[model samples]
Target: MLKSNFARFAAVGLAAAALVSLGATAANAAPVPTEGPLYVYDGNGILIPTAGHVFDWNDNISASLSATDMAAPFHCSADATDSYTFLAPQGQELTRSAWQAYAPNGFTAEGSKDLLAFTLSPYQQTNGTQGVAKVNGGKWSLGLACTKDNGVNYASSGVWWLPVTVEAGTGKFTADPVGDPVVGSPATIDLEATTVPVAPDVDGPLSLNVPVGAKATLGAAALVNGLSTSTGKLGEFTVTDERALSKKGWTLTSSVADFVNGTNTIDKKQLGIKPIVVSGTAVAAAAQVAGSATGSAPFAELAPLAAVGTTKLNADLTFVAPKDSVVGTYTSKLTLTLASK
Candidate 1:
């Protein structure tokens, strides 16, 4: 009976040891540690949850037809202000600092604000969109903000639909006289805009006709002529012949005279005057003629009497011709004077 009792006690001790080992193994097989719930605060110190914090939006972004001109209108104006609205998910607000607007490569924003205004309406749990606004012109981009826990800001930006209704007006340029006249003569023409912009599109191209009032003037004409005397006389004589003539009158004025006479008494008349006799006898008698009259006459004939006179005439003349008169032929009417006794 004592041996049986010892065996029973040993068996009971073994069972207790097995139970302790099983409990230790079970404790070692426990699952890995996990992170706790997320809690974040915004710049405004607003508490935001982690799991259900999602941003939902409904946008009615629109573009309208604007003004058109010489160039295409890419800008939006008050007349063609685009209207649109967006709704944020419940319990979410648009980050004011994160809002941004963009335009096409060449287009630009003109207004100061990207969003007109953000309002909290009476609609419970409803996010209100902003009012109508204008873009300078061209392609555009819209960006919104989402900050759930404020740890790191979230951003969403994209290009909205392009506004195709607006267009640029065509332009044309013209002058009064297409061709040039005289170099100095000016042709007159009116420069006008076929279509003026009553309501200008800030983005649309403006058409302007820059009228160029220009003219090509002609240079003064030149003339050359050969001058000669009617008489065969060779000795230098005044150039009395008037040749240089212009619309403004004659420029050159002077008379030339040449004469030759023999020693024998010669009778001649000029300008219908009485004949005047140049007596060689009287001249020879006065000079003491020792040789025959014929011989003396020959010696006297060697030298003849000569006289010349020149007078300058006025250049100023009154006629239909003017200094800057048109280019054309002109003629002068005048009288010549002579002395005879």
Candidate 2:
């Protein structure tokens, strides 16, 4: 019985060993790969590169006209033939005739194709004060159709930037002094003149019987931003003592306590109420009465800096009549010039 048991154990051991050997052989076996051959062409579509990248069309083209193709710049005829060359790779299995065969599917603008063309229309474009000529027509895309070794049809395409220009429109150049309150489209400020009556009675030792005074106000600068330059300036206020009855003397001054930019409020003690000494004049030869005072004052400095809005300047003129002097009409010309800096 013991012998019979040993034989049965040995047979079981052999069966187990066979199963382990089979598993080992399976793990050691090499895997087989399945892959197809890769085929490539000389070029995506057209083998030769086109000449000329950017084209600048001259005045010959008109904005009013529209057509399938343009002349000269593009080098392509209006008929679309002979303008561009269409050639296939030589000595290759694929010929221009077999081009469609490779691509069983048809060619489309977006799809694979043997040939393609695109165009853009002319439109208006503006850059600041500058005007750009109508773009007219531009080629957006150019592509050629080709066939692969397989049954699939493909297209090699390219995009180009074709900028054509026409005669540029003219631009305007202007310089103006705009006040806090804008007057016109380009902007204007008013520096009006007014006359003030003085008390006849003398107040103190240095006082006189009466004095006829004229007031001139300064407006905002259109182009002058409180800076002085050749093209423009902040502003200037000139007074020409054209004809004054009194020969004794006259005084010119400002009401601005502190000439500052961007100040909204006109200070009672500063703006229209301050005292400024006015001296200097380019008196006219004919109007130069003996012992008469005439001069031009520049208000450009009173203009605020970098202030894009309006500003104000008040100029006061006083005529110091000689005691017991002639009493005729006293007149003067007040000129205010607001310039750009």
Candidate 3:
């Protein structure tokens, strides 16, 4: 349900925009219900109101649209194509993006494909306010053949109105005060080691890196009550993409060898990991498959880090041993592969 901030506008004078309903069907002009299968979010990641929202600026790269592929009653089929065409207030079509894969129910992101960026520049909002134009983030065609299953499909145009208010964002931000610190005579100062060293000026290209000899600690392994599960942390690494704008996107994948100690061996599948993006926006981490535990999940190649620049990456390590296995020191090698797209 729409919690608050819902300001309804009469569908009163839309004659110039061609005659049609405000919703999916011509007879119904109301917005989709909160429980609707299709949901659209604004550039700030907030659910767009039924009547849509007002923006202070255009060129929003954070906007995304997602629709659920229903099952059972409203089987909208799997992997249906979703197309969105933003329309002008005068009913002229703006831009359109047609993606083939519709998300499964409750799926926020698939693999490294999470957010969809959008923009609406040259909108020209003046005099405090502008249009209440129709911007259909997307429309679901929900193959009607499956409606025989007695379930209704989200076959709406899923259109949202975008009105611009330029006056709301006229204020400029002030900088915070900064000054030198004055230490009291009684203050104690300890000299800590620093890693800042002089380096030659060089603009390197794409690179996968970690500080030299920077190894992570995965605490000692021990068996307790015949069930021994050791969890560890992977060292951090940096991925940099100084490539041209055309070659910006990249993917990161990992694979581990079997943990072995002479005659003892632990399957690589028994050792799972939890991938994490320490820093970087638009860098998603659904590349991990965690079922019961944090590190006990399958990791797929995902695209988050190195979106256009650098990213810090890490993963949680877990080793689940089989019952009656011999106890001994074991070791494994983890390999991370990076590729440009």
Candidate 4:
């Protein structure tokens, strides 16, 4: 239910519109509610052209731009070719990307956190069992920017963005030949089908056997040689997918709370983790994150698999406490989450 607002528009990497700064205020002030795909927002007395858009996933979502038409929105000139592109913010889990090409440009709106949402529905898999599918589809983004000069000598740019949900499609066709069609006269048949993208299911109601009472003695405070480390025995994680017909994949995520002992504290980022699949039918280990991640880097503590099957995941934990720290026993909680992609 939260919205992430973008900052001034700039298509530096997407296309050749880097000079088109949306933050360039015009010499004259314009009133708000300016009609068109773009609108003038009277930020105090500085007018700014702003816009928003939405698109569907798995489809060739695009928009045509003419210098003239684009100029109208931002009150610029149509003297040059319009610049445009669909920007995919880096570090975002695109899953099944639909962009025609990779867009290297991205921007972080103030206070914007990478947010994602999905709607699931119950359905029968091809194997004749119950399964879930994404109804609204996954989220992504599209970026647009264009600018021109006509004596205005000022950059007028606008942005179009919204939460886009893309869907995958499977098409099949059959030829209903009419009485043995000849080479010149071929039979014509039509085929059409629409279905939901099968959602992944977790084989859980299980638990990771994380070791209890993990300890990391500070290098200076270690009794038997200054070796400081704590290993966790997160119980064995098992992932079993009986639906061989489903193509959905999943990821196991690990996040932790800050280690704290009264007033003394250790950021969760200090805890290193490396998840690996010791035994599995079809599963791959995620890259070792080495204890570093933010909301934008969700994989710092994660286990990712490509194939569908039963797999057991485990992690190597190294809790490192810095020197000059309190001597109290700090406690922290570790959490593991399984999600479908």
lDDT (0-100) at residue 168 of candidate 4?
Answer: 30
lDDT of each: 0.19, 0.22, 0.40, 0.36
| Backbone clashes, candidate 4 | 11
Error of 2 at 134 (Å): 77
Best by lDDT: 3
Question: Which regions in candidate 1 have their CA more than 4 angstroms from the true location?
Answer: 1-98, 101-135, 143-146, 150-152, 155-341
Q: Which tens-of-lDDT digit does each residue in 1-341 have in candidate 3?
A: 21222332111212222223222222222222111122234455554432234333343322222322111122222322332223232222211111111122222244321213223332322211123221232221211111111111322223322222233233111111112111221223456786632223532376789778666656776765556777778877888766433444666767667778898887777665777778764354554432233323333233433335667788787676778667876777777777765
For candidate 1, lDDT tens digit of each residue in 22-42? 112211111111111112222
Q: What is the lDDT of residue 231 in candidate 3?
A: 74
Give the C-alpha miss distance for residue 95 in model 2, angstroms. Answer: 92
10 residues in a row with least lDDT, candidate 4: 116-125
lDDT ranking from best to worst? 3, 4, 2, 1
Clashes of each: 21, 20, 2, 11
TM-score of 2: 0.16
Q: RMSD of each candidate?
A: 39.5, 30.9, 25.5, 26.9
lDDT of 2: 0.22
Q: In candidate 2, what are the lDDT values of residues 1-341, reduced to their tens digit?
A: 11110000000000111101111221111111111111111122211111111222221111101122222121111122111111111221112231111112223333223222322222211111112222222111111222222312111211121211222332111111111211111323456798632334431111111124544433332222332111111132343321222212223322122222343322122111122224333211222111233333333332222212122223333223333333333323333343322
- Please give the lDDT score at residue 96 for candidate 1: 24
> After aligning candidate 4 to the native by TM-score, how far in Å is the CA of 22 from where it should be?
99
